[model samples]
Target: MKNVLRIIGAILGIVLAVYLVYQLRTIFVYIILAVVLSLLGRPLMNLLGKIRIKNFRLPNSLSALIVLIVMILFVVGIFSLFVPLIAQQARIVSSIEANEVARAFAEPLNRFSQFLADYELTEERFDEHYFRAQIRDILKFGKVSSVFQSIFGVLGNLFIAIFSVLFMGFFFLRDGMLLQRILETLVPDAEVPHVRVILDNTKRLLTRYCFGLVIQVALVTLIISVSLKFFLGIENALIIGFMAGLLNLIPYLGPVMGAILGVIIVMLTNLDLNFYSELLPKSGWILVIFACMQLFDNMITQPVLFANVVNAHPLEIFIVISVAGTLYGITGMIIAIPSYTVLRIIAKELFSQYKVVSSLTRNL
Candidate 1:
């Protein structure tokens, strides 16, 4: 009777905790951002600490402030560089005429439609006319002003969020164990050692993973930009490269989406060219470039980041990412491996007696 009651009480506690977390999700977001900032900024903080004038070194507060400013400037610089390019592309897509696009591709599109019909692949007729309608639907964005207005509306509280995150991040960088100290107060005194170990392991693993992501994005961007520049006649190769790099954040599915986007943009830019002989050739080369990039990424980069850095098996990472993507979508997929790594660290400390936990966290 006592055991049954205890089990029910435990389940109720878990439910209540989840409910509270959901209510305070925004605060959690800020904390997560602060933690990430602290991780990224810690190296700079260490470097600043080593700098001295005679016998005096930089203070922790001063170091943290410098690190914070540098990170902010980097972020602002990235936005400044990319935002205008993106906005320009969006304007081009939004303002382009569907009729003109259809007319440009009409000959090849008609031939392709006939091929599909001859093969009985399409149920109803599919031709340039059907594609012409899709052109408007696919590229439709009312205006750039309206789009940024919606973005500004959504980020209305962005100032407060940034300030809160920076404040927390400064302290986190100043005192590396600040997060662990806070977590300790929540757990029992007996569990303090476990919490400390968990936080330490998570920090190291996540730092490597985060840096790996940066390298991957930059490398992918470079490959795509170079490919488009030399192999294709596209005018907006830089913007397309940036788009591919950003979308590559979504694991497994990202490369395919990037390829499709590359093709679409290729068609859009070369509307004045002959679709069959001229445009098609360029599009084919772009796909080949994307394919080669993906092959390199999958074979080399992903294994190192997702498997080696996290100390998890490749199959284990795949399953975890798949489940997270199914449950919470793209954002979930992006964070899945890191989140799972943290969970494994915690479980190793707290549930090592369990066989499954022991096996999964054996590497950690």
Candidate 2:
């Protein structure tokens, strides 16, 4: 009877937990972001804690505050540097007449349309009207004002999200063990050791992985930006570089997309009658630079990040990302590796008796 009651209680507890999570999904997202930021800033916080002020060590709270301030300043500084450029680009894009853009691409697009018509894929020749209509439909250009309004709306929300994340992150950094204590109290006594192991491993692995990612993104951005500015002489190099680096969060497909975006930006901003003669060569050079960056990333940065920091096999990581991407699209792919790492750690701690879990998590 007691065992039956305990089983029922566990089921009820799980259902209640799920319901609460559903109700507080937005707050949960904030908390998750806070936790990640806390993990990323943990090393800095620890370093600050170690600093002695004459004969006094820095308190955890003060250390966390300093780290938070530094993080905020770093974020604000990057935005301050890039936001003007992005705004300039946005203005350029908005100022570009749709008809002019269509006219610029008219020749090549007509060739494509002719090919399709010849192949019986389409019954009509493509003209600027058709092209412009397609672009408008695809980009919702008819609602340009609304789109800008939505962007402003998102900016407002972003400010709120940043504040909430920082507020929660401060607590997480200062009282880093609070979550563990709560978990210890909530978990079954028999499973407390397993939970502790899981949490500890999670913190270590995730902190290293998050920090490694920051380094990887920054390196990629710098390499691309410098190469574009110095070699290709591309205007808006910083924006293109940052966009490429940010897109690289998607794993296998990201670098390719980034390269393509670089080419598009070059074409869009440098449209001229000499597109074939001069711009084409510049575009090729841009591709080459991106290719070199990708090569460096795959060869050097990735190996260290995966093997040394995350401790996952390359093949395993690839398969996990591919599966997640297939099942849930880009967002899934973005999260796949870290999610898999967490799962692997937990499985290793909780189900070490299982052969597959034990084998897969042997390194962890």
Candidate 3:
């Protein structure tokens, strides 16, 4: 009876905690971003700390501030370079008329729909006017004014989020032990030492993983951008390439998603061209380029970076990411490896006696 009471109490506590977390999710997001920034900046902070000039070493606060500034500058520089270009291209694409696009491609769409109908694949006949309306509906949100309006609408929340992340990130970087101290208070006194071990292990692993991830994203972005610039002469190649690199963060499914997006963007921008001869062929070539990129990533990039950084097998990473994606979607897939790494470390520390834990965390 006592055990049952204890179990029920624990369940209720968990439920309440989850409710609180959901309610305060925005704050949690800020904290998580700060933690990720700190993780990425830690090595730079340490390196700065080691600098000496005439028996003078940089203070923690100064080092942390410098690191934070450098990170901010890096992000700002990238945005400054790409944002205007992308925005201009977006304006141009948004100004495109749905009737113009529909007039150019409507026949092909109808023929494809008729083929489907002929094969009894779809009972509904494709209407040209309906198709043009659909095109207008799709392009409505593609309007530059609409896009900027959406962003403007969220400016207040966005500012708060950015400021909160920056504020917390500075402190986290400055006081390397800040996060540890917070955890120490939350963790039980008896289990503090064990928890500290888990924290250190998780941080070290995640730091390496994050570094490798940034490098991977950079390499992918450079390749795709260069390929499109030189091979296809696309105007907004950088935008598409950056998006592809970002999406490639997800395993298995991300490359295909990026490819589809690439096709859409290409088609949208090239709407004035011949659909079958120029536009369709260009879109096809995009698929080929993305396919080649995938092959290269699978053959060279992923194996080298992730295998070393995560210390897990391909199959293991795939299963974990797939399960996470199923449960929590794109965000889950993005965080799956780090989450799995931390879970494995915890299991190895606390449940090493169990055979399954031992087997799964063998690399760790």
Top lDDT prediction, candidate number: 3
Candidate 3, 333: how far from true, in Å? Answer: 1.8
**Candidate 3, 1-364: lDDT as tens digits:** 9867855875696698768866896787688789989999998998998889999999988899999999999999988988897888878876888787777788888898889888999887675776788777766656757877888979978888899999999999999899989989986798799889988987887887888889888888999989988999987789989989988988788899989988888888877788888888888888999999999998898778767557777788889998889977887898888878878998788668778889999988
Candidate 1, which segments miss by more than 4 Å at Cα?
A: 1-19, 111-125, 134-149, 157-161, 305-307
TM-score of each: 0.87, 0.87, 0.88
- Stretches of model 2 off by over 4 angstroms after superposition: 1-25, 53-57, 135-142, 313-315, 326-329
**RMSD of model 1, in Å?**
3.2
Native-referenced Cα lDDT, model 3: 0.85
User: lDDT, candidate 2, residue 363?
Assistant: 85
Model 1 agreement with the true structure over 65-127: per-residue lDDT tens digits:
889999989989977988998888878876678898888877777888889889999876567
> What's model 1's overall lDDT?
0.84
Q: What clash pairs does model 2 have?
A: none
Predictions in order: lDDT: 0.84, 0.84, 0.85
The candidate that achieves the highest TM-score relative to the unseen native structure: 3
Q: lDDT for model 2, please.
A: 0.84
